[model samples]
Target: MKPAPFEYAAPKTIAEALDILGQNDLDEVKLMAGGQSLMPLLNMRLARPSLVLDLNHVEGLDGIREESSGLRVGAMTTKRVLEDSDLVRSQYPLLWESTVAIGHAPIRNRGTVGGSMVQADPASEYPAAALAFDMEFVVMSSAGERVIQAEDFFVTYLTTSIEPGEILTEIRIPRLPPGTGWGFQELARRHGDFAIVGALATVRVESGLCCDPRIVLFGAADRAIRVPAGEACLEGAPPSEASLTVMGDAVFDAVEDPLSDVHASAEYRRDLARVLSKRAMSEAMSRAS
Candidate 1:
């Protein structure tokens, strides 16, 4: 299979890209930063774009900058670059961990952060990372720019709130609060395969009690879902086996009717969600404490 015939353009500036998007926005104007995901889709004939917009020469769309609020990551930042950056490894270890969990080395070498989120695979780690970290996505378009919360960004599987002619510019992640813990866990068919079940947990621990508990899961449903009910079940409780079991049950109870495929059965995936979530939460709370 091959994608339908398409035109290509490389725009150096945001304005130039916007001009292209404006003209071809409704004409399957595909944005191409890296060929990691789009190439495959194109070859499989799953996505047939009339125009491919290359964003390489688009400056200011790559790099890691820090500010009083937290980390501001350019959309075009590569997974390998983020993985190698000392600032990310030292300060945002969970994000670093998630980076490694993305595809294999070759894919990571060229895949961009923005592409991953824009692709919006339900099992993809970026969406979970953004939701787990409560990040905000800044999108730019001819109409102007607006910030969309991560929760709202992921509208459904392979879909996002980004409108046509809009490009994701950057992601904003708040600095980890003091005494905060974080963890990322996923159960994939293989290490690099799309996960059948995954979990990301973050919480603030104070005086030996959990506060601000947050647990978000991926790969078990159509989109990533925050399991506050599961988190609430862990409130004020130590990470004991009994407490974990209860929280795990809550997650399992909340995550039912998961999509079944060759990788796993719906029931099995839901069960894995419960188990992985508990382990992730335990590790995250341990680090927070």
Candidate 2:
């Protein structure tokens, strides 16, 4: 299938892009980053926009910068760039693992960081990683820029808090404290396939007790979510098999409405969530120690 007829614009500057967006009804204007996700939808006629505003030519929106707080990543930065970044690999291993897990090398070569976050696919790794790391999304429009917390950014499947006419410009990730350990796990049919279920965890062991533990899961809900119930189960608790089991049970119970698709049943997804949560937490604890 071919895409519906649409006007196309390649803006070299964000101001130019914003001007175009302001003139058109947002529903009729679709923003194109890397086109990895949107191209398929366009080809299928699922997205019938009157205007496809391409951002590829836009400058200054594709790099990684170190900040005192942590790192500031441009939204248009490609996944391949992220995967190959030594700073990312050393300072944010969890993010590095998640980046490598995305589809294949070819897809990563063109898929933008902002594109995946805006796509809001429940099975995607970035959303879960965003929540686990408490990342912040920076969006811009004529009104100016606003930062959205990860917990509030993702609203539902294929949906986000980004208002029409707003463009995602950057993602802010905070630096992990010393001795913090992280883990990422996903179950996919193939090595590069979308995960059927996935879990991400972070832990800091203090005096033999888990401190500031976080557990996030994707492919188990309409959006990636942080499991406070699961986190509560592990907070201040010894990083033991028994504690992990209880935390896993909490994570399983928290996923009340696991997505049911042809790939997996709701029951199966919930079980995978439970199992993966335990494994991820165990790995995080081991690394923390």
- Cα TM-score per model: 0.97, 0.99
User: lDDT by residue for model 2 over 1-289, one digit each (tens)?
Assistant: 9999999999998888899999999989999998999999999999999999999899988999999899999999999999999999988999999999999999999999999999999999999999988899999898999999999999999999999999999999998888998888999998899999999999999999999999999999999988899999999999999999999999989999999989999999999999998999999999995
What are the per-residue Cα lDDT tens digits for candidate 1 across 52-81?
899978989998899988899999999899
Compare the candidates by TM-score and give the number of the best one.
2
Provide the RMSD of all predictions against the true structure, rounded to 1 decimal.
Answer: 1.2, 0.7
TM-score of 1: 0.97
Off by over 4 Å in 2: none
In model 1, pairs of residues that clash are: none
What shift in Å separates residue 163 of candidate 1 from its native position after superposition? 0.5
